[model samples]
Target: MIFQPTYLDLLLSGDLKKRAADFQRRLKACDLCPRDCGVNRVEGEIGFCGVGNQVWVNSYGLHFGEEDPLRGWQGSGTIFFSGCNLSCLYCQNAEISQKVSGSEISVEVLANVMLELENRGAHNINLVSPTHVIAQIIKAIYIAAQRGLKLPIVYNTGGYDSIHTLKMLDGIIDIYMPDMKYSEPEISGRLSGVPDYPSVNQIAVKEMFRQVGNLVMSTQGIAERGLLVRHLVLPGGLAGSKTVLEFIAKEISRNTYLNIMDQYRPAYLAGRHSEINRRITSDEYQVVVKEALRLGLNRLDKC
Candidate 1:
């Protein structure tokens, strides 16, 4: 089946532009993420994410390191947005997320980047760490769609999202790839600096699933639309992988495309915490994977 991007329909209906404008207006108060920073980003007021009106892009290119469905044969077109709403203590991409290293560009240039990635034969436009920059991204998508950018958009988030902002993105985004960081609020707060992560993340995931149901793939195995959940297996069960898996199986969907990642290593300030000071053991990874399977989550990513 030929897959058309959801944003194209919104663009035709003129809702895309309206939504873009509303999202742009949000930058004034900047309640884009769960942070509710309320800083006037339009007037160059830096919020928790440290970004203003202009979109700051760390890098843009085809990335094959993503999930199989997203990467496919052509690779997923990734735009790594600098700065993040949640500060994960063990974040591997600390240079970009925490320090916010990138060049600021106009919405037109951001749109052009999307077009360039599509021209390079990317399966989808994956916006990495996008929760804080929703307004900027929405405006860029509006411009990109006007300039003939038709690739499926992937909202690759850290899961600490605002339902209001996500409601604005209902039909605009195609694939919703979010990380289910922790099932415990205390663990999340201690590790990611977000005390309300569990509740916020769960709500965001449910909203994402409501927008786009289960994973839909093309004959060539590229994701067209879906909610793909990622849970990095942390050392000493700090991630609460079992409970998270159960939630996915019960609340989300038993067939949810889950990536039980084993790539957790002590990066950033992880060494400060004894429990998360080292890489996850092979046994630890297996335990989580076993629980996921036990929960009847069949669509586990073969990584």
Candidate 2:
């Protein structure tokens, strides 16, 4: 059977638009994320993410660099949102996430970008770094759905999301692909500047799994709806890979689709830190893979 996006139903019932307005209103205080910046984003007040009322998009296109399920035959329609809620010291896309390197666009333009990607044969609309600009994304998705956009919406977040915000996005988002960056609060605070990342990320992931049980796919092997987690293996067990996989197996689901990422090259301010300055060895990646299998996490993503 072919997959139908859930947001289209919300659009038809006009609930999507209402949710958009409700989300936009939160921008007044801007407690959208865990930071609770409290900045008046509706009145163009910039906060920790450095984004204001207008939506800034670094770029949008059909990208094949994502997971195989997301990319499919054509590609994952990726909209790289400019700005981030977390300040990771080793961010790979710091140019887009840290520094404002994209052009600002209105809701109409953002909607058009989604439609254009669908025209290009994209399997899904992947919103990257979406935690900070969720209100804007909801507005654009509503507009896109009204204009014949019918692809699954992927919330590609950094795992530092607020449960309240995720609650607002319950039916709108089809795919929840979040990164479980770290397992220790102190490590997260020192590396990513988020002191409560361990607790916050765990709660956020649990909520995401509750919304979409496990990663589901169509006959064509394209992702339909569900949760696809990413865990980057930090050197010297800094990411606590064993603990994370155990949580997935015990708390979440053994069928949870997980990607134990082996790509942890030191970037941005990583070189400043002695422990994370170097890249992970082949053995390090293999160790995490073994732990995942041992923990009964059989649905590991293919590298």
Candidate 3:
């Protein structure tokens, strides 16, 4: 790889190891995400995310369904961590996220998965739903970096992250692909079970942009580093898509790489909320995209 991942520098300087150890220690109380579930994860006590000390992985493989830059010809290496900080009413991946259906594995196995994906020619290691397991992921990254894992680490999240956790990952993660789910706190509360999602997500997204700036791609069109935001348009304007786009364009960056997703279908508990129990129309999708462009956010990803 021409573009070396930033974690290697940390690994060489021994900071990666230190961070890993620090994260491991935090498991005693486990305040990693915004939920602040102070359960003793090290003692196998499940918290709000239904996660314990060990890393729970549902699956791992090359995923082409990601944004174009992240998924090139080789595909993005996705390690689907099975648990989440938020319980979205319309959760698309409810089977895994809500139920927490995955096997608990050691950090060594997670590191091996990273190395295996790297050897398989994956362009990047994508950590799906990783907010709850940041400490374990960092520990695994430290291990994998020592074992010749060179691909950029993609921190794919739902944007309900804590500032403390994001601050700890300043130089470790390369690509920060986070979802700006909602702008209205009430909508977020009703749909996602997080009343403060708007405030928390906005702050987390801004921090992600600050950490990595705009998306950068290699000559081969594969993402090397930086922040990529995804905003899924919900039916009937429930997601407050316009205000969410406005935040990205104004508060974050006009040059920010954004994906205005339209593939929102009623899934999981979405049927309960009648307003969001249908797919978004083409007009609904296009209007948000046009508004984003009008706001001068031209770096749109055709996902």
The candidate scoring highest on lDDT is: 2
Tell me the tens digit of each residue's lDDT in model 3 across 1-303. 479888899999999999999988888998999888888999999899998988789999999998888889988999999988898988999999997777889999999999999999899999999999999999999998988999999999999999988989999999999999998988889888898999999999888888998899988788999999988998988889889888887899889988889889999988877898889999988888888889998888883
Cα displacement (angstroms), candidate 3, residue 201, comes to: 1.1
Lowest lDDT 10-residue stretch of candidate 3 = 294-303
TM-score for each predicted model, relative to the true structure: 0.98, 0.99, 0.98
Model 1 lDDT tens row, 4-119: 98899999999999999999888999899989999999899998888888878999999999989989998999999999998898998999999868898898899999999999
- Where does model 1 exceed 4 Å of error? none
**RMSD (CA, angstroms), candidate 2:** 0.8
Candidate 1 vs candidate 2: the lDDT winner is 2
Cα displacement (Å) at residue 122, model 1 = 0.4
lDDT of each: 0.91, 0.92, 0.90
Model 3 vs. true fold: TM: 0.98
lDDT of 2: 0.92
The local lDDT score (0 to 100) that residue 236 gets in candidate 2 is 88
Cα displacement (Å) at residue 195, model 2: 1.2
